[model samples]
Target: MGFLNAVGNVGLALSVAQVATASFYIYLEWYAHGKWTGHPGMQEMKKIAENISSSSFSTASTSSDELEFLRSHPSPEGVASSIDKEFRRMEKFVAFAGRGLTSSWSGRRIVVTPSWILFSHRTTFLPICQLLGHLGAVVVGTRCINNQIASLGEDEEQERADPMLGSGVVMATIRIADMDSGACMLSFDLPASELENFRLYLCCPLVYAQGVSLEPSIIQRFLEAFSAVVQENEPIEIPPSMELERCIGCLSNQTSVAIRRSCAGECGSCRCRPMWCEMCVGRWFASRLAQSHVPTSEWVASRVPCPTCRSLFCVRDVISLKRAQY
Candidate 1:
């Protein structure tokens, strides 16, 4: 039954892909033929273009009359508006494709695109996948978790047996799978709160697969494991002892004495030496959050890992360091 369902989903996806590809090519050809050149909005655009061309040929600044004309014309703004409208249309087509593909599958749905399509149009495809990913959808060619089953505990079993018990009760089976690898990563029956973090982690690419949940402590462990893996695969380079005294993030000699005291023993008792200033670390944290595809608002509460040691630290920790006195 599962094999049949999978085959059906593949056929549906192929059909949707064909429709989308045809629509995109048709629109491109139409656009190339200047079908929209005679649009009613073009009259104002033509006037603006004439004014701009004339301005380019003249050395003297335009008079107040010309400035007013330019302001009223807003040719550049009009062009941008048209481009935005077309982009929205394309976005709608992609959304429609995603929805149609998802509805054809049972259980958790995953949308798989040909590797050629992904490589050729990654910029367009990534955003669409990201949108679907946020809504509990999975995209192919990335790590994901899928169909996990967990056994119910005795108390939970009794709750399920009770006819009076309502839908408020959490289920025993918690399934999570990696869509890219097409393998189930977690299947244990954990609390829903704990499970929520795993879901969030899967949707974002900042963290790698570690066969664990997303609690701060658990994430720290994952980072440590990741660091070990990275270290094993790469050659190690020992920094000079003098360089170690400066901030690793900014290479600044100015260190915050107060932060060192406050965060004492927080970074683990590694005698390897602490080499980051408060301000530098703060900036580094901000940069990581900015680089992440996950929405900033969503990650504001998340902890950041150290660039040097992969030790997980919170924004508050970095902020405190930033405000620390000598």
Candidate 2:
């Protein structure tokens, strides 16, 4: 479930980032074309400029229609071509920013580009970084790297030897600051593969967590706590019955069954079968909810109703069956 949520967020971030990049360029184009004349401040500035020019030389006053023409007409061909080139460059830059998350780059030193630094202020960018960090990438902010380099001195070699650096690693350098001192924090390298399952430290939105301390010990504790919570909440597996080939809900001979109702009481008066693959059951549940006029918040009150008998079942009544063969 957590993995799915992370994947969904990544897709969403990519979409939003693309739209924002396009909007930014569109605004720049508008500014360059004098479309900003619609603003009262711009009109005042234009009047001042005209007065200064008229006093020096008897020039014909520009008309509102002329101003409107300037705003609507395209700039010179050279200027239009230049803006088109810039648009392409901006697209490439946006793609490069998201490359770390969508593609694997092993053994490469990922530097924070100026474009990324500028866009990092957007809310979408941080989540993309956080998701990548959670997926075993080592993110080193710009401030932290500067601080670490400044303090190198005699410990430079020692820092290099720190077990964190390893081959085929995805390392990211960012800019983060210390909460209390407002000073840039120190940076460190890490083996990306080793941190694949390390969620706690990466899930905290470290990029934006100005209030939280970034000390190694504190980060270690956070990881430990997250691991404990995950372990405690892990669902127990139940042995499958002989009738696993057929879905209890639709009696369909699907190859994979995602959910199994092990508890009899939860079925209540429902005559529908208990075994169900995600697709079949999910559609039924969604359709049932869609037909109702209830608010989304209240839909959960209905629980997961059995498609056949309309009996409600709590989430605990069902267990997800793994498709993997032990």
Candidate 3:
């Protein structure tokens, strides 16, 4: 009986050790992947880790046989498979829940909505630690990469004098949002001045690119602690579209003022209008149409009949309706 009891104690210790080993490997996998792939893969791994945590607890609690099996069979491949499956499930959840959360958070939560798309040029680390120090965004994540901004030259300064060019400053794309809600604000031609804090103060190359949406609570907290290195609010100068001749709406003498949804579809352009304007909707349609079997000629015609909808409309009309509120 004494020997049998000793064997049971050893089995329990082995089970505990197996759990610890699995956790360590999982952590290593996530740490390695996060640096390579950025936040999306990290988030996916977090979801996987949560699943493993639950499974470990449940197996230890209810089923000793299952726990023993995992310990004896000990397959790293099995652990990896489990992680991948959980990520697939998260992708499905995002597909349905992403849009609504993005919109709601942007409208209600963002305190100071930036008009620039922010990108970090550093390719080494997830901006989480820095962002958490600067702003605690829960849903949105930022990555840092190394990129050099060019110094302004005489020729570039000359172009700035032209009304078409507006300012000598080069525009940047930036994304800012509440982390939890997934609501994001994208500014394509944001002023270089707004990023002064990150560029000069943070001593990191920042630019614009795609990023994960974070929850608002996380962002709010992050900003609260973020050091305000630059206090000067330079009024940004935005240039008019010079592509007027090639644009159907501009050629047709429609409203030259183009209102678009930067992140929250809350503005009149996104909410009141039945469809998105040619500016907002056409770009996406053009890419999708290019890949599809649709004829190029059909896209340029002013009042071509849409084979898909059987509706008669001009080039401008179709583009507008294509982006209309659905």
Candidate 4:
């Protein structure tokens, strides 16, 4: 009976110790938040924002591409202004131009401006992190098959049915790494047609093309074959009567490629007229290779079907169409 009582006391002591440790951790977190020191926790983020806003303001004041809002829109005279107050500009960019990817229900919602990128939790909408700039960007996943959204309203249904749906330029995960280090600081899925938006603001090099999309992509030169095929194929002149239409793949760029079999292989020829742009078709080829579960080395030798006609053709078969002289 005494031994059992002693064991109970030991258990009580361990529980007390755990509670004390937990309290110490909570105290440390509170201190890390700068509540005790009376200093801002986000000093570095604030400074980065300030620097970007000041630089943008100065450039707008000097350049021909000056924003009209800075002049007509009034702020307090002699008071330093911050771009954070350009709420309308930021909102407009988000609504109309669509700068970044976001989620409504859960996970992080991101917003990117020329000045800074903010990631906030969907629940509370409080910022998770703010990035002023990035070193380089890389995209990973199946992108060879570009899936144009059939209906914007049915996007949710489509995603649920086929998780591999590739909408817009890329249906892939994008990871942004720090300038000073290769460690990924931000990772997000690029929304449909938002790839160009990322390019416009961030202007970061595709680490994938630099052979750094994956750790193995560097040694394997994963993107080299796909890139080479597109660059090497000479442009085909379009007939004067043939109208240049919007690319079926991106629904944005003009259709500039036709799948004309120019290779010496067993691959079938495509009868379809130019329906995809150079970039989109290349992406389609890459997507096929990605889905094949084959090594990147074999991708260049593989054949892909035309998005419309379904006729199989090698990468070399994609020829850019030169707009007729009008």
Candidate 5:
């Protein structure tokens, strides 16, 4: 074969390989988390919350834990208590970090607290966020494509089921959501030049929250692929801005009437704003509550300085982030 032809074949092969690898990652992620068919685990969790017949609580406070109220609660109340307790525990350390992190059960949108985003910038963590954001965008985008293809008026068997065809886009979407949601965890210390210190936390959608860990290979490959895409295609950036119309510190921590009543801002209660990523924050709360440390109002009040400009903005201002679209 001619040299130029050989080079063309190699480029095509690499492109095909990239797509295939991306697809495999998505399928495995969906399969592991049981998200392919509308999140069976989350559905079960919801069912457990609704099940009045069960005497045994799906999530209950242990006797050793100091929070005895949760121990005394019934199954439904106990589960809600569990979510609140654990969420507080995991986020307690993070409460003082920055503003804009939100957790709202009423609206079903856990926004990345502005504090966390600003902290990333303060600590020079934008690259990490960007990488994760790109990953989320690709993954979600791929899912969108697959869903589109499946809906194209063809029989399920006849239409292509192969995720490889649109996997790159899927992975990209997932990364974007990860960054946007603020569930993308980064190493505490990374060199100024290298953003290799990031790993998707359990809060990430594709990874199982119950079984999450730092595995560098896949994340690295995804980053490299995404970078190449940007270098080659030069796509336009979609400026995103969050509108936080209310005080971040004023939000009710739990959706429960009892918890909200007890902890509402009017009651001299400090509210824990929602984390940018609700699912991630929910899982974080669940994990922490299992250990038993209710988040406090004071801890949530302390705010971190912005990483970029080092400006101190109120939680409300942080929530309402406005950026130029161009």
Candidate 6:
């Protein structure tokens, strides 16, 4: 009985130690960012928000750590006001949108003032904001290829396309490190479009003054594959008898794309009429691939399902609809 009690006590202690160690490391990551609220597990939270592609923020808060740091010097309010004005004019993005976890999609929003680079998120209460003054390096998070373009249930044809094909930028993660310590301070994922704005806004020697080189992200070269594949097929013209309707996806634009199964793959015959715009349909296809954790580069080469009918289709099937002339 004494030996058994000793073994059990030791096992309990080890288990408690492991749990404490894990919780400590988790808290450290959050502390490194700031005293922010709502702590979600980093890796788990990333999976939930990984597909959010686009810019999201342009405003600043007076309570930010940067403001306090700036105030430590002379003429605090003056500096803060100037920074605030510039930040407002800069437009915001949906980078890790709080509402996005439930619904809605948005992307990269990083504001650069003279003294600091502001990173903010849309939270329930005061937006969880942070500031980084150090200039370090940036790196991408992730890529692929195409082969047997198979429709749903065509396992033999779906050989996981060439992993090397396409620009290979699925969900690009931009890792921003600190200059002083060379430690990663902030890192987030952004879609292809928002990356353009990121490079443009920070085009200066200071960003790379520490001899930093950036990792390749969702550059246009990678996106050109998607565009090329999408453009490979011609648009399908609608007859005068068929009336165009608002897109079900956006509910704003007229339905301009039709999914008439034209791919050589064994795609199911979709009888549904055109009810989606080209952009919405394309985005929907991309989102489907992303949500499935598939490689972004194999997008055009891969087959997808019709947004409405669930019938399998490929990029070639997405035909832009044009009204017939009288």
Full-model lDDT for every candidate: 0.35, 0.36, 0.30, 0.51, 0.30, 0.50
lDDT of 6 at 165: 29
Residue 294 error, candidate 3, Å: 14
TM-score of 4: 0.36
lDDT of 3 by residue, 219-287 (tens): 232233221211111221233432322222112233222222332222222222222223322332332
Evaluated at residue 66, the lDDT of candidate 6 is 44
lDDT of 6 by residue, 1-326 (tens): 99999999999999999999987886776555564222442332232122111122123222344444434432323334445665675322234433211112233244544233455544311111123233443644322212444221211223233233233323334556645677765654444444444442331222323343345544344445555665667767678898887665544578877788777888878889888766656655665565466786676677777755788987777777776788
Evaluate residue 132 in candidate 6 and report its C-alpha lDDT on the 0 to 100 scale.
Answer: 25
Each candidate: RMSD: 19.8, 25.2, 22.0, 15.4, 23.4, 16.9
Clashes of each: 10, 9, 46, 3, 50, 19
> What range of 10 consecutive residues in model 1 has the weakest lDDT sum?
114-123
Q: How well does candidate 4 match the true structure, expressed as C-alpha RMSD? A: 15.4
Steric clash pairs (candidate 2): 140-172, 140-173, 140-174, 141-174, 141-175, 142-174, 142-175, 248-273, 248-275
The 10-residue segment with the lowest total lDDT in model 2: 125-134
Q: Regarding lDDT, does 1 or 4 come out ahead?
A: 4
Residue ranges of candidate 3 with Cα displaced over 4 Å = 1-171, 179-279, 282-326
Q: Answer with 1 or 5, whichever has the higher TM-score.
A: 1
Q: What lDDT is reached at residue 282 by model 1?
A: 46
Q: What local lDDT does model 3 show for residue 183?
A: 57
Write candidate 1's Cα lDDT for 1-326 as tens digits.
Answer: 99999999999999999999987775665344665443333443454445444644244222333334444444645433433443443111111212211111112222212100010122122111121111222211121112222223422321121222223323223333434455643232322222222232122222224353333433333334433432333222343332334443333345431122113334432222455554444444444553454564555355556555556655433321123133
| Top TM-score hit | 4
Of the candidates shown, which would achieve the greatest lDDT relative to the real structure? 4
